[model samples]
Target: MTVSLHTRRRQSGVTLLGLLMWAIVLGFGALIVMKVVPTIIEYSTISKAVNKIAAEGLSTVPEIRAAFDRQKDIDYGITSITSRDLDITKENDKVVIRFAYNKEVELFSPVFLLIKYQGTSRTTTR
Candidate 1:
């Protein structure tokens, strides 16, 4: 009996079509990250602002809203929500400020991405 090594060389590596599909997928992922990062950053800024107001011992709704407005003016990243949009209330003798907003990012002509952000202040007056 003799051994034969002339079998089909076998198919290896990615084809052009496979590479293109991968590229498209990766490209879309990158685009999504690009659009989402700034929004996340802005949300973080807003959260900090809320916490600051809560910590500053602002006892009234107007005062808390005013503080947020000032913070918003200082931070350019904050745009989706405003002081007037915040929901301020008293709970258990503590001041609570809550806010929620939606951001729409236009990816293409008719395609838009919507991001919902909601947060509450950490500072609650006792």
Candidate 2:
């Protein structure tokens, strides 16, 4: 009597190279998130400050800039732009505050990420 030969089933899973590649991708993603989140938070803080100052009825440009400086001093997150960087304007009897800045993040020794942030506050009565 002849015995039947059994066939081996192929394993389905990540190989060593695939696993390493995935690990590298995930690591880079984590690094970018860690670097970019703080900038986003700082931008939010700046936006809130601008909106609040615009609504506070500061008619003069100096007053608005000073208020922003005070707020920046209180909130340590605001560093990318200063009070002087603000572009204050009035439109339709409403105060508007605009700001723009650039943030450069270093990914490695030679690689960098440049982010440009710009925002304007809601028009409010001065």
Candidate 3:
């Protein structure tokens, strides 16, 4: 004749603390992507310029450097390295242009990210 009591199940969901933590993590990730994408694009531009100059059959170092400088002027993305920083070499009678540079990006106060970029041109036979 006694009435039975129904047991209540505990609710399961993300708490306020958990949601805040996830928001912080996602915000930090987005910040990093925003900062790093431009540098990657710049690297791609520099690589294309080097490959184009190498395939142009420029025999002299000065000519190659000047070509890169011109390309840099045209494509405003090249700032990490300059014409003087390039390592020009000849291999098997083909012009090889090599470049290496470092980019520093500031994520927050007292914290910095360093990225090293290097590339060698893909030369073509005339």
Q: Ten-residue segment with the worst summed lDDT in candidate 3?
A: 1-10
Q: Which regions in candidate 2 have their CA more than 4 angstroms from the true location? A: 1-7
Tell me the alpha-carbon RMSD of every candidate: 2.3, 2.0, 2.2
Best by lDDT: 2
Candidate closer to the true structure by lDDT (higher is better), 1 or 3: 3
Per-residue alpha-carbon lDDT of model 3 for 1-126, expressed as tens digits?
655565655689999999999999999999999999999999999999999999889999999999999999999988888999999999888889999999999999889899999999997776
Q: What do the candidate models score in CA lDDT, each in turn? A: 0.87, 0.94, 0.92
* Predicted candidate 1 versus true structure: per-residue lDDT over 1-126, tens digit per residue: 655677647779999999999999999999999988999999999999988888888888889889999999998889888899999987888778898999998887799999889998775556
RMSD of 1: 2.3
Q: Give the range where candidate 1 is weakest over 10 consecutive residues by summed lDDT.
A: 1-10
Give per-model TM-scores.
Answer: 0.90, 0.93, 0.92
Prediction-by-prediction clash tally:
1, 0, 0
Best TM-score among the predictions, by candidate number: 2
lDDT of 3: 0.92
